[model samples]
Target: MDLPAPLQWTEHVLFSLLLAVVVRSYVLYGLTGVLKDLVKFLRLLPGVDTLIQFILAREVQTFMNKVSATPVDSEPVKKAVEIPEKGCSAEELLQDMAELKALETVTEDGKVFAYVYTMEDEHAKTLRKAFDMFNDPTGYDGNDKPSARENVVNQFAHTFLHENALSPMVFPALRKMETEVISMVATMLNGDSRCSGSLTTGGTESILMAVKCYRDRARELMPHITEPEIVAPITIHPAFEKAAEYFNLTVCHAPLKPDFTVDLAAFEKLIGKNTVMLAASAPQYPYGIVDPIEDVGRLATKHNLPFHVDGCFGGFMLPWVEKLGYPVPPFDFRVQGVTSVSADVHKYGFGLKGSSVVVYKSSEIRRHQIFAYSSWPGGLFGSPGFSGTRPGANIAASWAALRSLGEDGYMQKAEQLMKTTLAMEEGVDSIQGLSIVGKPAMTAFAIMSTENSGIDILALADAMEARDWHMERQQLPNTLHCTIMPHHIGREMVFINDLTESADEVRGKASLSSKGTAGMYGMVAKIPDRAVVDEFILQFFDKAYKL
Candidate 1:
């Protein structure tokens, strides 16, 4: 029987898959879970022969936010019109904003997702005022001149209004403040003088810069390999996958064990000649279990690879947890093989959004992250980190926020957050059909249906959402995520009550699983082809901008 080229290729894939399965079941003599991880190393095309093996399994998908046909809080614009015929009065604009603000997702429940919600409204006021004053950069004909307003803003925020971080020579104050910020974060992470990094816009930018640094470094050292790869746990942040997609590298995901930590043996096996970098998460987002950083660090040392610990979720809070006497594993530059570490200052550091840091073990390695071009019309052009026209206001605001919290404030908040999280964990465990995922090492954890409980966790999320409690939905085991903040401290019982009611409401009603947000994620989870999944997400994005 004559077969098409694609079919023949599929045949080969299936044959290999079957042989691997037989070896695992018969020859291997143990449910090691390494075989599937080894199969993940293969970069197959068009997604055919392997379909049978993994049609029901989760695909290696990439997305900033999950696409839902029935998206939550996607309030449509009130009305569409051309550019206004006349400028509206300020009073009219404020009235319009007030009406819109009333429609916010958080109702009286106040269970909105701010795991470390602190000083948000206060910091937001400064940021808003700063952004408002800079409506048009050109409006500043006399903007450079100092005023009483300048002193007032500086006294509170230290913001360099209308300032650009394009060139530090032009804004020496920004350069100095940014230096001290980096140094402070490095010292907190237990790094010495050798530690170096840049304050990026956010955690994504920090991770992107780290990947770029190692990729470029490998280009110089290992030029023979055109396509480089990163070996990381499946639980690694999607930013790494995003980095790989942007930088033309592959992310080989290793499987997790029963506890949801990366299978270290499988992780080590994935490391080959082409592997340029290794990454582990400090309390990875889904499970909130810090991947075995010390073990991965040892692997990085043995393989002579640059390791990155993504502490974006835990970086700011871990030290406080450790000081509070929580047994946190050493996850910073203190580990021998940990070459770079990323932490989101915007998260637990109490900084406003658009602030994160990725520190390195040495200045030499950090140098590769910088981009420069001499032959240009603008003369020597250079950018460290992603943004060229970086906002000086963000740097100033972040600095102010950090200084305001100080060590004592953060520790106090950590104590509150830990107490709330543990309480929430116990409350969640008390639920009959639901369970918290993994041994949560920090503030975040996911709630999942217990095995054969017949509880659709996604349906439970919809039930919570309807109650005006902003919930986070997760997959790869179908769960809902929750992180306890200071605000959540007194409201554990409220959430627990809502959760218990939701569970009871959904019990024996399997039909609810095919409705609303649950239906969307459930449908997507079953698809094996990554291209199909990509297209499904693309349609959601396309529709968003269809107007």
Candidate 2:
């Protein structure tokens, strides 16, 4: 069987090549099998079992704890042995409401920041009168009166309440009010006549609507996209997180620069084929610093994704501020690529709570915001928002708030608010231990203590509370926050004086301790596992309803 030397060499080479192919194929197949098994094992772990359960548990626990720990409602009402068999008199109901109001803790005497947006007695009376005037009109129920069993205020209480918005003939007034509100807001935000929107319950609903609209639009335009995502700065409201959770969208949070503005490079890197929306805040909630919306708009244009400006906090402030000659950025439909915006009327709009608007640049895009069901026994039902039946009173109140505080009034209020805010900013900056977080061009601002100041901002907040001033404490960088309102204009000096004294007192303490919900927030910030924080939030909600 011996052959020539060349032929023998060729035969050997052929055998070696065959053996190499077999070995390589087996190695590749084994690696693939191992990877599949590893993925399956990871998926089976308890930690990854049910994300919904994990997330909801933490939120529920935190909520419960808050409800339970509220000290104002110490006496639980007991059931009566027999019914009165008749409705209570109006006077009796009024008396009961007054009693309940008296039981509420007065934390608004400058002791708390951002919650109440306290007003002077005269202003309070005015607001009350306005509220009473429309409380029964336009078919809206009272918010929290004397009775708990009354379903009159349960969103849809009037005869026209259950009428379907899907059919314009059934609830024409609802559609009209909704349209007018959107038009008014759009005009205020410098949108063209073509701009349109729908009324949402609040900022979160508005945000969710925008997300869903953009997601659907993207899918229609680009059929291959299977996974959609949103790119937002870390400072954007947590409502976006809720939207992502509910819509099965991935949220990529871009980092903030040292000054607390969105990092442009990081934002760009996070964009991919599946990114359907880009979000920027006009004065984000944490530090109240407006992002570079013009730049973000440009990025959105380049990426061909919808740009959403979340002006829930500053929607009413920015236009007036700009008119006041403050250095403001373009944050509305005027900016190209800014397709949608969410603004809350309850915040700065001075409307009663539970009203917000989400506007889009064009009615074409807004078509996606509508929800419809064609196959129900109740007939074809459709609504613009998540709720089945919304309160017409809120709509009416929103209209009244806007009409009452016309452009002139809003401008004046904005001016006063800016003055107060500037004064507070200067006061905080003058303090040895404190520094302003960012250049707050609007009414909202934050302050943090330096290491040299020997003051803990959280402790300072607690001390301020002792002085009957309520200021919010923020974590990420450990700061104190304030949102100046019309009522705070004249009281600026009082707040400054109290804050100065509080800082001094906090500085004297060798160690600081946070109590109550403030302590919970501090602890939640330090926890590395977000799941634990979620549980704490849930507990707070649960505690809120304890009787």
Candidate 3:
């Protein structure tokens, strides 16, 4: 950008002004084009009509509130609950908190089997401390707030600036850490020099990004494809279906064999011209059985499709399990057609929650996952994935977890988990009616009632719950899914005894009549129109959010 030495001051001024104008006009044009596309896209969204109706209703309500100020004689509505007038002292507050916390399903006894994962109590303390350290400072750009900038004492340790259109003035150390995290995950997945990726909030976000990448890539290659489709196994995590719903893509579910592995022939039949990507689970959550990733990878290569292996539950443990002489199929970048792989550090990596990595075969495909805009009045904007203000403490803690528990430590954990899983399998087998489902490739497995036995698995699950043993029930095979973790290692005897008792108690009581939760699950499964099930599930979630 050097200027000519012979140029006069007047000519230089004119040249600078002209350059500024050209740059401004170019940015404006790009921005305008993006805005137009955004408007068009928004119009197609299902929520848009609802949004417009809401705006109109809000306007009318506001107008009414202003003009019709006459008060009614009805008694004023009372609050459902009242807030305290004053804050309690620390000890008192904590004591009160403990009272509420005591109501939680899982406690020191560790009866619960799902949702929560814990290592040593010391590890829990360390993660909690890490979270508290950065709980006050945000990862937003602090350049505009000098006071906040002044409080940023440990740039490398505390805050990480927003990744989207990351400010040049922000701390560079955090950025470096993020890059290293991606690189570490990529290496673990057998990625090469060209592999690139981003750290997402969780496995769901990672899957969403992958879906978006393939959808956009397909759009670029085949503009005529208005309705892109994703071919995935029915056992694949529901996140794929959620992503499809959000992005207006269709998901074709392939059936699974008796072993819970996806049927390759049926999968091939589902593939069509509109198929943008192929997805399968690496040790699927339902039965903990690894899909035929190598076979699916070959199919992807033949169809020239991007293959995504969701290892969110097993990514961190499968490698070590393979190293420990267990048979693990090639499910990562080592598989020729695996365009992306998602691994959750939170699950088996023993990292804090809200940490997962989504890696691509190369930066080329990753570019499609990123969102960028050039025409904002403030400045150009770009974000790697679904969020703008993600928590950085999770990233820091995730890194710390990895650093604290090196290869040997993870292998030790895997060994313990695997041993516990095998023991649990034996324990289940010992029960006359219950047996482990499929060949569990990892720490997770499911127990189901044998056909020869008259026991009902769901009834047995309800009996187990009655005995204060929490077990996650599955629908497809009517099994109780269990994930063995570090906490469950020494409690094997307790688990076995309780399970044996529960099974004995429920033996020959019912004929799989589907009572309680099982009844709901059975009804949903047998429904002809899945939309009714969807609505019921949606209502269930709505109830969960209620106070």
lDDT of each: 0.76, 0.72, 0.73
Model 3 agreement with the true structure over 1-547: per-residue lDDT tens digits: 7557666676788667656655665577776655665555556668996897778767756654453313222322232111122322334433432442233232235653332345446776686566556443322121223222213222312332212213211323334446666777887788866778888889999999999999999988888889899999999999998999999999999998877778899999999989999999998999899999999999999999999999999999998899888888778888888899999987887655678989999888998999989879966677888986555556654554454445666677788788888888898899898888888798999888899687878877787788888879888668889988766877798999999888887787775457876566677778999788889889999999999
Model 3: how far residue 491 lies from native, Å? 0.7
Rank by TM-score, highest first: 1, 3, 2
Model 1 agreement with the true structure over 31-93: per-residue lDDT tens digits: 444555445444344565367445533331211114211222333223321112232333443
TM-score of each: 0.73, 0.70, 0.72
Rank by lDDT, highest first. 1, 3, 2
Cα lDDT for residue 451, candidate 3 = 92
> Lowest-scoring 10 consecutive residues by lDDT in candidate 3?
76-85
Instruction: Count backbone overlaps in model 2.
Output: 40
- Candidate 2 has an lDDT of 0.72
Candidate 1 vs. truth: CA RMSD? 21.4
Cα lDDT, model 2, residue 364: 80
